[model samples]
Target: MYTTKIGLAPAIHDSFIASEPLGHLLQSSKWQEIKDNWNSEIIGFFDDDQLVASVSILIRPLPLGFTMLYLPRGIAMDYENTALLDYIFEALKKYGKSQKAIFIKFDPAIQNLPENEKVIQKLKNLGAKWMGLTAEMHDTIQPRFNAVVYKADFDEEKFNKKTRQALRKARNSHTIVKFGRDELLDDFSEMIQKTEHRKGISLRNRDYFEKLVDTYQADANITMVYLDLKALLIEAQTMFDQAQKAFETKETTNEKKIKQLENACSKAKKDLSVLTDLVQANGDIVAVSSALTVNFGTHTEHLYAGTDTDYQKYYTAYLAWFESIQYMFDRGAETVNMGGLENSLLETDGLLKFKKNFNPKIEEYVGEFDIPVSRLLYPIVNKLYMMRKTRI
Candidate 1:
């Protein structure tokens, strides 16, 4: 019989997940550190004393001494193997019931492949419910559709037009910090708050930001992307001065050098004009936008980002994303998970449109499923949950 263990050492979980293909950050123990707000457990399933599957399950306390077991982008395992999934879920249900959990909610990262349909049908036959793909935001705990950047043959000649533009602009301009200073976090949080306010979405607290970076520490897994606008302004001025001096030089011939000088002067002037405008608005140096990425396994996840409301015209967000893509790609990452977009190709949300710059493939997960400990309480709790969630 297969066996399961709870609250195992992180090394055990790490080793198991690392051996698998592209373990999600949510399934990683690193996420356990960041999600300190919830009670968590590292679970492992074994066959003949050899580890077969592992997951990080978060427990949320509910009313009347009951609990809800939630796995965010988790139950990370081989979805194709029905035997493994059947064994693991049975163990999980038994353990969840023992822990007074009313239900166990799972949203695996499995896409809706043709072969995957067989697995879904098998799960249904085994009494597992399926939430059919829906574009509604509240239909699932996480977005059903996500933008995934796959590792293709790196062709320098054929880049997405927007990717090319963002890269060129970033390369020619200011600094892109991988891990910015602590002081920059406050600015980043403020920017996020302002953006969230404008968009009418709920905003996270500042401590959430601090804990995420601090939990990841200075590891390559957590990449913080930000721009030093002051540095760009100063560099632009220097380039302008150097270009002007070179143009006035006597040694310069009226050939290709003259054309080069003219082009340099023109670019420097335009950059100066843009930089000067930004500097005048924000002061000596300021962070216009910032993004935090979590690198785990073979993929880098672009988790959260925000732009200064005033500096949107400068396209700092696009630049930040471009540099982040390059950073992960350079380090041999297999994919860049650009995060979620609502289902539906016709959706014109700005978030989806912005992430579309990278020409990402839309990965659709088959929403969430719930395994209830008590069938009688399931509908009651779900109705209450829907009511409360809708109010949000």
Candidate 2:
């Protein structure tokens, strides 16, 4: 006795299963809250009066008075239940036709599909066209990915040996590792910045990272990694020294002001030195990584990770990741997902290679699947978007 209906609005039935951030990130968050805001409708699916799935569709106004329905992570449902998928698509198609949507693009979270071809074939048979991975992710909503997942009974030793030499190296190094968000954020931000810079990319400023820490810190599962005082001290001293030297050369005629500035500098340097030693004394060693463990029922995903790449030679990143994985396993996590990456750009790229060294089995997923409601107008919109990209 199964029934299907589109829950147009969020309500009590949606609460049947305990909610988590993944669900919210996929459904509940306001349309405007997403960094790439979309204008359109969001719908949730219910079965037998129980909420089971949800979807967010972005309808972009196109030229010649047409629009398109772009579903980032669309059509969330019970993947194993073919009937449920069929019911949900019928509801979506009906809804799309009414709104004059050009197409519906869905990227379900179902991974490790036994037969990718069969699933694609079934979708096509269901009137959902298969859009191959062709364009850059910007052209689509979610990027095609091969996620690295640690299984329920993952062997830590096996994973370490298969992945990277660094994890062992990190353990051997005398670097202090501290977990939890109570630790200093400025240091973490700096470390992340250094890593990003090394990879020839710019990272969000300290404020953005601080927000992640502040928002998720209360959750005991969220962990932060810390490197030793010696490493922190080296960078801190270097930055301070450079600033102090520059300040000394500035044309300042006031003797009293100069003396006051010198005293401040001296104290600051002294404090920095002491703090460095303090961190060094609390040794866990080599490197550290901070991560937020997100739980959705029994499934847990590692959201964001910040690591000390400066000590890569010592394999701090590997050590930090290995320990973190062990920590997640101990917490009864069914899956420890490393999260998605810009794989196309990274494969063969040093960072990609580094992440791969961990011996993670690839979880291949569809790049972006779209169901066009009105194909005629969608092209015009696509052209304009391409033009804009070219201009940028």
Candidate 3:
């Protein structure tokens, strides 16, 4: 028998933690720290002898003692199993009722493969209400995807003249691409701040970005493009990590320790080799973007991409994107998601227009779905929050 329960404490789901499908972006220590510090409840589903899946729902208080649950890139489980899904949701419903939560929310990490339309339908059939337009991306923990998913096989013939031209231009441009851990984060922070300010949006504080970099540095890819003489222009990141497997440092003094040390040395040597390659470049960075790749057995998401506007004329940002697409293809990725579209459908959205140029077949994602516990109070609280946002 499988058991489901609710509690503030972290679940003892070591097995799921060892092999659950999610990226480091969702599993970063900083994100976890933030969740833990905030009011949260762990919804764990367990098999007789093992904890199979779990979702951590972080709650925020609302007026009149109401609360809302945010399932941040959550619902860790076997989505193909309807029985498990129902079991999990039932547990959540019971728990929400007990907590007197206003509503429950989740945005599952389903990919665009097998078509996103089907996934949306499934969610509705499973008793989850769709909160946003099916065609428009929603405001949720994860960005709603309008991605380009490619097959595993490579097709050189599919490369159009424009794509080739972009690649050629990037190679011919006197620029260097650099990759590192936290070495360039402080430098990148300046670039991020500049871009955010231009977009009339506030960015994560310097400390938050630093903590993010530090937490995911082990597996994150920090990519930057520099022009002649290493002038920063584009700083795109292809951050990724295996969330299913985490290294558990063991206390040992024998062959195990020796092997662990050897592995660390080998990794350092390999990383240095790559760094050496980056240092040899001599171009100033003009535009850069970063993405987190989350793998879920049969799907993956190229999550989040931001660029610099200071050098938009030079089109360094295009070059960076071209390089990233090629990199994803080369890495045997089944689909290279260009990511979601925000305010792009508007006629004046230039960034959205640029992404559409990649010839991506745009589709909507299953956005935030809420299971309301207190139907009466949930709407009132939600309206107040929306009103506040609108005023801002």
Candidate 4:
């Protein structure tokens, strides 16, 4: 038998959460604070008097005096363990009745692997309903398909080879800037609006981001790819000067030194050309591309992002992600989740193509599940859910 309790010691919760191989940022305690409007609870499942599994449930008032139980990225537990899952369902149903929960929804972080067939059977055996496999972003609370960058034992430089190329091209046109509570709400809002307009997608408001940044503190950051033409021009002139000095040095004729000098001079001239063009076309900052990221345990996730399309030619967005990845590496994070993509498997998906530039592999999860507390109300709620999704 297992015991379900609300709120454990801080260390106990943190240790188990960090240890889950499939853990996610959404499950973090800080996230509970961000969703201030929702009634959130952290439930720990104990077996043999040891803290075994945990989950964070977000409850929102639904129609007709009922509440909806949403477990973002699902309950953090070993889904393959039948006994453990049995206890989880029992506890959730009992807890749901008291809270007037209509049904419990979960989209765990489990990936789609060949061996997961047995696990899928267990989920079914435990009376959980399966849902969703669409390529479109709609119809799910969290993305079912994700691109996670998890190679930490390897070289960060090798990982950044493509980013270095973007930096080389973007060097003379822009710079990367990271911001926090520094009035980023307004800037991010503007860029977010622009990106939504161009991409035909709906994003959250600035107020929501304010809460995210305010709550997550050390775990969250706002990074801007600032296209400052003046800064680029100054940097270009400095590089050109260095190249000129190196060309005039005594080692210019030495074969090894000559090769190095040529490479430097060639890069300086190429960057100067772009810088001159940018400075002439625009002054000061040409664009501001920003990305928001959160880190938990060994993982870092890039969430909402905005880009000023005017400077897309300069690849400022790529530079922004490059630096974001670097930030994760500096913190010794084992992986970086570059956010969501569609599972359509379409080779031409623009988002997929863009993320592929960073050489990240696509991860299609085992899919979402519906753990019904009241089987009678569960089907009724499904109809209402479809209506809500369409309205959105």
Q: What lDDT is reached at residue 367 by model 2?
A: 54
Q: Give the TM-scores of the predictions, in the order they appear.
A: 0.82, 0.66, 0.67, 0.82
User: Candidate 3: where is the Cα deviation over 4 Å?
Assistant: 5-30, 34-37, 50-52, 78-82, 110-128, 132-141, 148-157, 229-310, 324-336, 343-349, 356-361, 385-392
Q: How good is model 1 by TM-score?
A: 0.82
Report the C-alpha lDDT of model 4 over 1-392, residue by residue, as the tens digit: 68878766546776788789877778877777888789988889999698878888889988788998888886778766788889988888888888898788888888778887788778877888887465556667787788877655334356456656776777656575766654667777788999999999899889888888777777777777677788877888899889978877745457888888888988998988887886787666654788888888888888888898867778788877767776776776888889888768588888887777676767877777887876788898888897889898
Superposed model 4: Cα runs more than 4 Å off: 9-11, 132-135, 153-164, 174-176, 179-185, 231-283, 390-392
Worst 10 residues of 3 by lDDT: 236-245
Question: By summed lDDT, which 10 consecutive residues of candidate 1 come out lowest?
Answer: 218-227
Clashing pairs in 4: none
Q: Judge candidate 3 against the unseen true structure and give its global Cα lDDT, from 0 to 1.
A: 0.57
Instruction: Report the C-alpha displacement of residue 268, candidate 3, in angstroms.
Output: 45
Candidates ranked by TM-score, best first? 4, 1, 3, 2
Each model's lDDT comes to: 0.75, 0.58, 0.57, 0.78
lDDT of 3 at 352: 68
- By TM-score, how accurate is candidate 2? 0.66
Clashes of 2: 18
Which residues of candidate 2, in runs, are more than 4 Å off? 1-36, 39-42, 56-69, 79-86, 97-101, 111-114, 133-140, 160-165, 182-184, 210-223, 229-293, 341-349, 382-392
For 104-139, candidate 2 gives per-residue lDDT tens digits of 767765443556667777777777766565445454
